[model samples]
Target: MLNQDVLRNARSPGRGFAAAKRGFDIAVALLALPAVLGVAAVLLLLNPIANRGPLFFVQARMGRNCKRFTIVKFRTMSAGQPEGGPAPRGPDDPVEDERITPLGRMLRRARIDELPQFFNVLSGDMSVIGPRPDVWDHAIHYLDSVPGYRARHTLRPGITGLAQVRGGYAEGIRATVQKTREDLAYIDGLSPRMELYILLRTVQVVFTGKGAR
Candidate 1:
């Protein structure tokens, strides 16, 4: 069980950790730039022919300290279709929505759709490892309903994180609460070793498509 006091007393990463994290993010982003751009270029050309939509998807997400930032990704859904309102999806909905194009399914399974977020890390809007950012509207909902939820925002959101590696799609309030706990645990135990572990596990998740939705 999580200790409530630990959550309440959680501190942001130290200056050294913060500096190292940002430096690492920039270094990794630079190293991965060519591959990211190559994928984006291919997707841009193929998206028009295969998916018939914009190549990129951008949406507002809650960043550290509840700030809102635009998160970019490859567009995996049919163009112009509305994903219902801000309400969380129910259990009955498909893990990857039926609205996903066939190519989108492949992109998602490969976690390629999320490659665009490396720019967010490069820009300092996010980290390479931290709590996954929540959609703005859903962040509001979770803030109201989940205890210790806001504590996860003490650090910049991430492209991948401990909660993401441990928890799957948060379908409802219950699942959101569970994910919140995992996020809080990660935040409480932040360290270089743990960060490395999450990064490594993320590679496995991407390759195996574990808990991806």
Candidate 2:
């Protein structure tokens, strides 16, 4: 059965794992705050020269069970839209494309751009590990187009996850379907060991810049 004890709300499959997972997320987030915030602070100081943009890129995102919440991240793009339109749908998430500054690109590759999201994790708006949250607009599109996409939100969104490690940045609808499958798989296969494995893989991805934009 799906885990009824979500973080302050609904979560997905597994009996007692939901509560345990939230606890782990909280513990990790607490432990990580000092270092992560320090790095973010350092980056904030350097943003003028390297990034030349706002300190953060805040946006509404789809969280567990389709709940909307604001997700915060280090700004990787300029203050406005890349152009007068929405970020395009195809080709490896155009949100990360031409609009992204070079330093922003580096931040994304290193996963440093998302460090501020630890705050989101602490706020119960996210998780330490689970399906990564999608931007509200894009997530709306996927909900209509991709099968099982809604089910992927069975748990709080994560900073990193199986889809992020295995599937990387999913592009269009086909890739999103794959991402949804991995998300559901992660939900179904919840365990301390599995969570640990994902966390370790996240470390590797951070250092090696593999499977990152």
The candidate that wins on TM-score is 1
CA shift of 207, model 1, Å: 1.1
Worst 10 residues of 1 by lDDT: 84-93
Please write out the lDDT profile of model 1 over residues 1-213, one tens digit for every residue: 457877886779889988988999999888978988999889878987888878888888899998999998888888885332243653223344777888887888888888889999888898888888877777887787788878889999988888888875566667777887888888888899999899888989998998765
RMSD in order of candidates: 2.4, 4.9
In Å, residue 16's CA in model 2 sits off its true spot by 3.1
User: Where does candidate 1 clash, by residue pair?
Assistant: none
Q: What is the TM-score of each candidate against the true structure?
A: 0.92, 0.86
Instruction: List the candidate 2 regions with Cα displacement exceeding 4 Å.
Output: 1-15, 82-93
Cα shift from native, residue 58, model 2 (Å): 0.5
Error in Å for residue 154 of model 1 = 0.3
Pairs in steric clash, model 2: 3-12
